[model samples]
Target: MAFFRPGVSREAEVRHHADQEVGKSFGELLEKARGAEHELRRTQASRAGAAELRAAGLAFDRALTDALRAAEAAQRAAFGVKAYDDRIRRRKGVATPEGARWTAEVNKLRTLREENRLTGIARVPRPFAPAR
Candidate 1:
């Protein structure tokens, strides 16, 4: 009896592709966030000795706020969560090893995806089952 399942491998391939796409998107978001942070820092440093201290201070504040907002937005997109007007209002922050709180949510999503894939495979009838 042939043990190889035709569609099972294809389904796995599709899942892998989806995982890659999600990973790529997450990487892009992180990169963008980092870039924004770098730009904000550069702008702040350039205004360190300027005569217009008040204007520079205001600009620095705005840039810092924007950078933080971008970071939070990127994090939300990576985790597939709804964007909120207030960043701190979304989730009650939890403590975790290595400061990795909110990872449980990510694990939950991955588990759901794996379960879906397994369910799809299970729905495929056996190819060479003995007579009932």
Candidate 2:
């Protein structure tokens, strides 16, 4: 005989990855990027000294690069989670609403990531990476 625990549903576990881990992390990173961009623009428009402007620009570039890298990681994780959910649905012959929502969310994140990558001017500073 087997007992089913309502608290330990597959959907709950999958939802944690889709919503809590990847989604929240990406959202925070996006917010940070936006803040950095706004600061850069403000500094530029304020007619600050060249040194101040340059410093602000550098800060913004670093923040944007970090955010983009984090977003890429989040996107990859989201894709993996979506694929896992799809596989589970296929194996169980069940289409979960949570899974559908997660797929849509993942697509939205992908779109945002692509748009940011295309429009952003900053490149990750390779010199900052740790040596192997």
Candidate 3:
């Protein structure tokens, strides 16, 4: 026989909703991170400011910590640790480590493109000239 609590407290119910909201917020942050990554990839590192990249990196780190905290809180409310661990382990989605990896990917592309420009291996043949 399984022993069960008679009443599910309002606190538990509220926590469940909070967990869902937190997940959504985290997802939105991930989307922002992706956008930042796209912009960085498109921009040449020589032209991009280090300060902007640093801010983006910090935002991603903060979002990741927030997501982890929210997951832990949800597990607490659910009263199970194995299930939470299993879910995280099995998770396969856009919300993966792509957040951190994006920075490196963008930087790699920037480095390659910068090297090409320095070596005169650009796609364009010549600069356009204006009529006198």
Per-model TM values vs. the true structure: 0.28, 0.44, 0.37
lDDT of 1 by residue, 15-122 (tens): 444544544454444455445445544645665433344343344444434444443333343333221222342342223231133354345434533543343122
CA lDDT of every candidate: 0.41, 0.55, 0.45
**Best candidate per TM-score, number?**
2
The superposed Cα distance between candidate 1 and the true structure at residue 92, in angstroms, equals 10
Model 3 vs. true fold: TM: 0.37
Q: Candidate 1: global Cα-lDDT? A: 0.41
**Clash tally for model 3:** 0
Q: How far out, in Å, is residue 104 in model 1? A: 16
Q: How well does model 3 score by local distance difference test?
A: 0.45
Candidate 2 lDDT over residue span 46-90, tens digit each: 877666765666666666555555554444344444434455533
Q: List where candidate 3 sits over 4 angstroms from the true fold.
A: 1-4, 25-27, 42-44, 47-49, 62-132
**Candidate 1, superposed: residue stretches over 4 Å from native:** 1-51, 81-132
Deviation (Å) of 101 in candidate 2: 13
